[model samples]
Target: MFDKIKQKIEKAKGALEHSDERVLASIPETSGLSKKDIYRNRYNHGVNLGGCFILEKWIYESVFDKGGDNEFDAVSSQVNHSSVDEAASKLTKHYNDYISKIDWNWLKNEAGITSFRIPIGYWHVGNGQLLDELPFEPLREVYSRAKPWDILKNLINKAAEYDIGVLIDVHGLPGGANTDMHSGCKNSSPSFFNKSKHIDKMVNVVLPFICRDACVNCENVIGLQVVNEAVFDNSAHGQKSYYSRAVAALNRIDPGLPVVISDGWWPDQWADWLGQTNLAAKVVVDSHVYRCFSAEDKGKDANQIINHLSESISWPRDRIDFVVGEFSCVLDEETWRKTAGNRDEWVRKFGKVQTSNFANVASWGWFFWTLQFQYGDGGEWGLVPMVKKGAIPRRPQGSPTVDENRVKEIINEHIAYWKDKGGDAMEHWRFEDGLRGAIADINAFAQFDNSRIGRWKALAMQRRAQYISRKGDSKYMWEWDQGFQRAIDEFGRY
Candidate 1:
């Protein structure tokens, strides 16, 4: 089945290479878009639905009252204390009630969240079959009966009704991506990168299943996160090799679907690597930025931290699309102790700077670390409370409308500047066409959802390909590129 899918992808690539209009048309238009089209075009102002599927004891302590620090121990403790069916029932209840319909309504209507990053485990897929020969195999009966994949599908379909996108984050790999408890186990030592079979299951079996199910069955799924927080030496542990295979397999399943990869706490390294490698047309880097973890961050006062953020948090703009996949408003208590200002005031300042920096640098906007917590309003970590406190903006600043008069003025300025220098040699009309093309795209997205286009680099590349295919190559193509960039900058001004 995998081989056949690869062959089909190759054939499709050949056909697309042979024809330009076919490729252009393949890029979905705004008016009558499929789910994949919606996923591709919109900027994501998202929040993680943490502790729903992938259990985190800190997020909700009551769920772990039975004595377990991680999902593995949680289930193991429950099964030992009670019957397998009862343990399954308790977990199923947690899943069902974690995010209710009312929460969804609030996210879409009031909070203006455009997407959700849903974390799940490898054991969550195939119900029980995926757990075979893995550490989670002992608890297969509980998950198989609970049927998280089915519930996840329902959530995806529900998100679609609200016109929200979902990114299925494989938070927990077969062994464990990192030593963290959130990796679906309580192991002191991580073994996911060390085991070839573990990578195989994820790249071949698990990821392909997710891509097929999402693209075919649940279109609201924006992308499949290959792995979450992979802590390893990139070159030594088959991490890069795993990424190559995962990208290939997913592209074969659905070339339109995007694949997200973690930066392994090394954004600059991966950014350079991605710039050089021909991995995929739509690969994104997910960088989880948190200021509270490091000792340096802990020592800084609120103002100092904010200044550090302004200075330090930046990404190479032209390389690849990267998102602050996870970030929070919380600062360490040590920093809070050093500050003299009111806690609420400092919290607001902290939140504003982080969001501002992320907006300036992140290609697809950002997702707050979490949406909710079990206890007292979740303080800085919760999206709902943070929004209520005016930390994160209610919605992205509204999309800018194209001012035709201003556009005309710019066009006139361009033509007048180049007329004497180029005479007939300069093709100024291409610039006008490119500018108008950008305006049309902006308007199309605005009509669709009052949003600006996200992933602008990838979309620009596609538009360029379409242009070259239609008009053939020319020395004057730079004019079009300049015009497009000008329009983008103009829109940003608004």
Candidate 2:
């Protein structure tokens, strides 16, 4: 791979006029594996590169905001230009500076992450976002001048140099998908809920990554997320029909390409829908679990928090195929103040538990919310800081493993039962096939103490009901709890 890249570099030098984009695109993504390889029972051990491509909500005031409100406001105000060309020029400098600050090499080689999530706004297509929504002329001029999408494409290709996969996340939709500024506009009313065409527009931008031609492609440019944090009510915004439309469109393009969707406030609701759908195998649900946002965390300690996370969130979460999209080791301000021992040790312990629970429960693993953004932005909550300080592990551990010895025992027991019951009929069953089948079952159920889906349902309901009834936040809990029960019904007793 190094030799091939060196040769490309040498070739590019000869052809001096070849644009930087063309020169960078020449590097080959050596990983021969497709997107399916990452999602098919493989845990996603990764970090989200937030605030690099898009000015994220968390990083907005710190980085993008000089005096303005959001990314759009800040860029326009900072540039303060009447000429579109001048605005674009200044924006180009700012865009490149942020991208340059990221250490992709360290993320891959040192951090040991398998994937990186690149968040982009819908307007990343170039100038416009939607028909009557968010004109963004000032930002548009800059994007047009910088050709930011091309730079992003180059970054995707460059990441392939270390065989790291990229999850293309459409962070900001046309009108604000949610009340967040990251959605481009800060309108509390979700303008994206009713807009079907906007979904189409986002998909149009996403097609290239998943549907590469026969010649050049990056193996690690794995999949595309429709939108980042969509506002989901019973309405179309975050519900199934909304996602169904996006999923159907993508499947029409390529059914094999993995499509990731944020649970849109109700992860428990989609459990049955995803498992039963034709798109189940190709779809991934993203559930952002954050304790910092609510007033409820003010009273809880680390032990109470971790316990609640395990029983209510993590264990029940195992019943479905999902990933903990965003998480941080930073406890609530009050919790932090009351905690004892080394703060670093506390962070390490919290991070370890969080990662362990996700690996053991969620079908795919977790991604730490961010790498590093500003100069000194990473610490307790940041992935790079946790890694540098040894708070989080570089590479994630394997899937929630089974007791190999116990599995062998179960297999031997099953084999003996078959042998006793079937005399001449035993010849029908191949020894290897029967043994492998028995072993697989054992591995599948060992996480739940060798119990199958039927028993898992009973226990999950009991545990979750107790949690929700006792201390569940969110007024949406009742609806989601019902949805969780419905999912259990759909899967049925295995």
Best by TM-score: 1
> Over the stretch 1-494, how does candidate 1's per-residue lDDT look in tens digits?
22343354456556667564433332232224343665665678899988889999888665587888889888889899888998888888888878672377888888888899999998888676677678899999999898888888888888888878898999998778788999988767778877888888787788888787765556678888888987847563467778878888988878877788888887776777776676535788888988899999898998899888867888775667788889989999999899996898888888888887876667677889898777666788889889888888777547777788999999899988888887469877677766766665665565445566676666667777776776676799888877766776677421
Residue range with the least summed lDDT across 10 consecutive positions in model 1: 22-31
lDDT of 2 by residue, 1-494 (tens): 33443464456456755644322221221112223332223446678877776775455344354455666776676666355566566556656777687777787667777667777776665433232334464455566665767777777777767656677777777666687877766666777656666555544544343344210244556566776676776544345665777777677766555677877777765666766564555677777877766778767777677677776564344455576667888788788776666777777888877776765456556778877756566677688789887777776323334354754554355457656665335332223222332233222322321122222222333434444444444543433344333333322112
TM-scores of all models?
A: 0.88, 0.71
At residue 448, candidate 1 shows an lDDT of 43
Clashing pairs in 1: none
The parts of candidate 1 lying over 4 Å away from their true place are 1-35, 232-237, 396-399, 409-431, 475-478, 492-494
Q: After superposition, how far is residue 165 of candidate 2 from its true place, in Å?
A: 0.3
What C-alpha lDDT does candidate 1 achieve relative to the native structure? 0.77
